[model samples]
Target: MISKTTIDQVYEAARVEEVIGDFVQLKKSGSNFKGLSPFTDERTPSFMVSPVKQIWKDFSSGKGGNVVAFLMEHEHFTYPEAIRYLAKKYNIEIDEIEQTSEEKEQANEKESMYLVSEYAQKYFEKTLWDTEPGKAIGLTYFKERGFTDETIKKFGLGYSLDEWEAFTQTALNEGYQLEFLEKTGLTIVKEQTAGDTKRFDRFKGRVMFPIHSMSGRVLGFGGRILTNDKKAAKYLNSPENDIYHKSKVLYGIYYAKQAIAKEDNCFLVEGYTDVIQMVQRGVENVVASSGTALTPEQIRLINRLTKNITVLFDGDAAGLRASLRGIDLILEQGMNVKVCTFPEGEDPDSFSKSNTYEDLVLYLEENAKDFIQFKTSLLVKEAANDPIKRADTIRDIVNSISKIPDRIQKEVYIQECAKIMQISEEVLYNTLAQINKKEVNEASKKIRQEQKVFEVVKNDPLVEKVDVQYELERKIIEMLLLYGNQKQKFEDLVLKENEEGELVLEPEIVEAKVYEKVYLDLQEDEIELSNEQFKSIYYKLIESLNEKEDFSVNTFLSGLNQEMVSEVSSILMEEEQYVLHDWERREIYPKEKQLGVAQLVGETILTLRCNLIKNRIRKLQEKTQDQHDDNSEILEEIMNYLQLNKLLNAKLNRVLS
Candidate 1:
């Protein structure tokens, strides 16, 4: 177990923004930092990091927690792992109590997999540096590509011996399980027809590249063959399994996440050597999808760090055509994607090796074209000298433009395309509008179908749902704000069951704030949140209710995690929609949009409805006999709910049909 002293030291030394900024890209949005939601696929920034509170919130996902929580959510680290990660990040050396070998043997499967993969990485690296064949083959291959020893070590480059079952035998002897090794694609196990199973190394006889998750856990491996075998594939990758999903993995994200976040832009490449060469040349904010076509999952992985992506493509016409679809996927996510094509016959690896860093950067800067323009022009040229294909090409570009989720981006691209194609802007706009309309109609139809399947659950026919009581909620809000500022006092009672069967109140009582009052009351009555958003708002409110000062909305907003703030802000602002505008204003009884007073109203209303429904449900549950049929019980509930329905209608100022 980690000591409290160590935890405190780690927390104190760790800067929330600095720690989180390594994994998620953050930009200054007022006092707090905001970036694209790491939890969701988004274009606009919704993830927020607040250094003041030392917490982050994803407004889109409605999840906000402190530094440790962010690690748990983003990296999928366990509690102890998160703490250790923080300790590692801040350079706080952990001095843990040693466990016996027997106790250490009790480690779980996932941790064992990690250990085995890490061991394989070390084994491969050792083979490369420590063995003659590896040095002659794997080491020489990397050096020939201009990769420095430091870069090789940084990327965890290694080599596998040509001998079958070399790694598998060593791992098995070290007490690692073959099942996990096979699952991680580290070992290839095959069953013989007449005898028992045979196991061999999957990456045997190849130079190795370990693909890592963002937190530096070994997810899988990529291997390249050195020997000439006409039938054998040049390079082989680890197959997808529980731990490694190729679509979601990037080649060098472990090294590039910080640089991408700091630079506010990512340099995307096609291959692993390209990433190393580019970063070595001072283009640090770069990663590769490992020579595969970009997936939405892969794009979202980059989306976690930066919104601006500069895709480095080869100058080969075929490679460019093959890779254009991936560029379209980036734009679909609402990210700004720019293309940088290297000189003819040169990839990023060769290009950077041949030119100075400034020249390379300048080459990319001068050549980088917007994905829409680049894609359109490429297809336009391809369709050239073929009139039938030209008409199809325009439609194809329009279809590509239609994939963009943002309205403004779509409009901008359409205009650019119209200029390039010598087509009317109106025609492009009309095409885009038709596509959008069709998409909306299809989306609406899906929602309607989904709703139909669950309509009964959404409505409560047995009882009238209560309207929220705004005034009482206001009182609670006031109490939370004021009482939180002051020390809380609550009536305390002490009871001893051993000597006497009597309960007595303690002599000294403490003050209670609205948060404590509400929280304690809910706990005492066994009340729980029925929805996740309300649950989030409730927790954040509870968190802030104790702060001693005048409430500042911006500070409150900034303190909450990124995703929840957007939602809470939107909800709080949405509640003021009933406000009388200047033109429509004749008499305004209650002032609107003044501040969080709207949020307070909305929260109060929601709280009242939830509580009222819960109470009614509870009462109905108690009265309903087990012998009674569902139809009769529901009828009885409706009869018993008339007064509550009248009260709800009166408060909401609307009748329920």
Candidate 2:
């Protein structure tokens, strides 16, 4: 278990904005930062981060949380892993009792696998430098490709022995399980037709590349075979598991994220060596698709860091045509894409390495062209003198334009395309409009079908029979969260004597705080809030009123988890948005002394809950009504309220005090 002091330090040190900024490109908007939604495909930004509140809310997905919560959500780190990441980033030292061998045995399987993977990364790195075969096979391959020793070590390259089961046997002897090895795709198990099972290594005779998550946890591996085995595939990759999703991952992104953010443009290449060589040549903001077609998920991954991407392809026309489809996907994401090609026979790797960083930089700068122009010049030549082919090419460009989600951008591109093609803008506009109409019609038809089914299914009488009182009570609980801490009191009955020297009907004087009154009123009626969230809020308000201090929303809502933060922040913030404006704010309207309704309500509801909670606690001492109790100060206050109520009721009933 982590010490409480360490946990508190972790939470305090991990600023929400700073942590999330490492991934998302955020722009200031009022008191919050807004950016495109990382979890969805949207042109407009719906992701928000509030530094004052130390929370984030993705309006599109309704996900929100503090820094730790984001790491858990975005990178899928567990709580401890998230904490450890923050500690590392912030340079905080973590001192914890190490788990013994027995405790290690007791660890969960997932954790055990993580530990094994981490250990293997170290082992592979150690072997690369300390063993002859690793240095000969892996280091030689990397160096021959212009990789520095530092790059090889940084990427954790290694070589597996040619002997079958070499790594598997070592792992099993070290207390790691064969099942885990097979499950992780590090070892392969095959059965002979009429004999026993045969165990072999999956990455045998291949150089290894350990794939890592953003914070550098070894998630999986990619290996390239060296032997001429016609039956076996040359390149082997880790199977998809809990931690590895190929479509969502970019090779070398973990190391290149900072450089990408700094440069504000990612240099996208098609293979691993292309990335390593370019970066090794001082082009730091580079990543590879590892020879796969671009995916929206991968594009979103890049989108998280920057909105600009420049793709590097072989200058050969064949390579450009092959990669043209991927460029359309990039443009559709609202990213700025420029296509740059090398001299006919060269790719990004060879070209970048052959020249100095400055020369390569200048070369790419001169060669890069906007997508439409690049596409047109490259294709117009091929379709020359063929009117039908040229028309088909124009349609292809229009279709790519239609993929853009932004209206303004699409219009600009359409005008640009028309100008470049010497065609009428109206014709292109009509073509785009028709395509858009078809897509919208198909979408609307699907929505209507879904709506029709939903309407038919939602005719249940029980759905309409939900209690309104429960909803009102829930809202009251929310109101208490707003005004529970404000200092306000309600009028209660007070005792007085009549002119005849006897108790008479009169209004009683007693102070009841707003929060205490609300809490006690609900408690007195035994009205359990129907919603679990409201119930929790209610109990917390009572606890705070009993203590008589400022309520801590942070403490009250701790461990409610990420799924609940958005709902809770909405409920807590919606009633305050009105007061957040300029004219009604304190800084703007202090002379008028006008308070926005939300500010007023936020203040009032908090005190109301506080007072209600006070009343509920005072009622606990009903046994000591109108009587003095020296046991405690709270007991004395309870006696006073009881005595005051009794005297007023006696006066109303014409009874003696």
> Which residue runs of candidate 2 sit more than 4 Å off their true CA positions?
96-113, 193-195, 227-232, 457-460, 464-530, 537-570, 573-657
Q: Model 1, range 1-657, lDDT digits (tens) per residue?
A: 888688767767777788777777677765677777777876666666667556566767867666666776777666677778888877899986654445446767776667678789999999999999899999999999988898888888999999999999988887778888897889998999988999999988999999888988888899998889877788899988877889889988998888887777888888878888988888888898887778999988888777889988887878777787887788788788898777789999999988899998888889998887788778888898898887788887898889878888888888888898888999888887888899999999999999986787667576556534433444454444333344444433333233564332233464654466567656664655555655666666777765534644444543455455544444432222232122335654554332343344334543465456656766676667543556575657755455454444444455655
Write candidate 2's Cα lDDT for 200-227 as tens digits. 9887878888877666778877888877
Alpha-carbon RMSD to native, per candidate: 9.3, 8.7
Superposed Cα deviation of residue 610, candidate 1 (Å): 15
The lDDT per prediction is 0.74, 0.73
Question: What's the TM-score of every candidate structure?
Answer: 0.74, 0.79
Model 2 worst lDDT run, 10 consecutive residues? 590-599
Per model, state how many residue pairs clash: 16, 30
Task: Let me know the TM-score candidate 2 reaches against the reference structure.
Answer: 0.79
lDDT of 2: 0.73
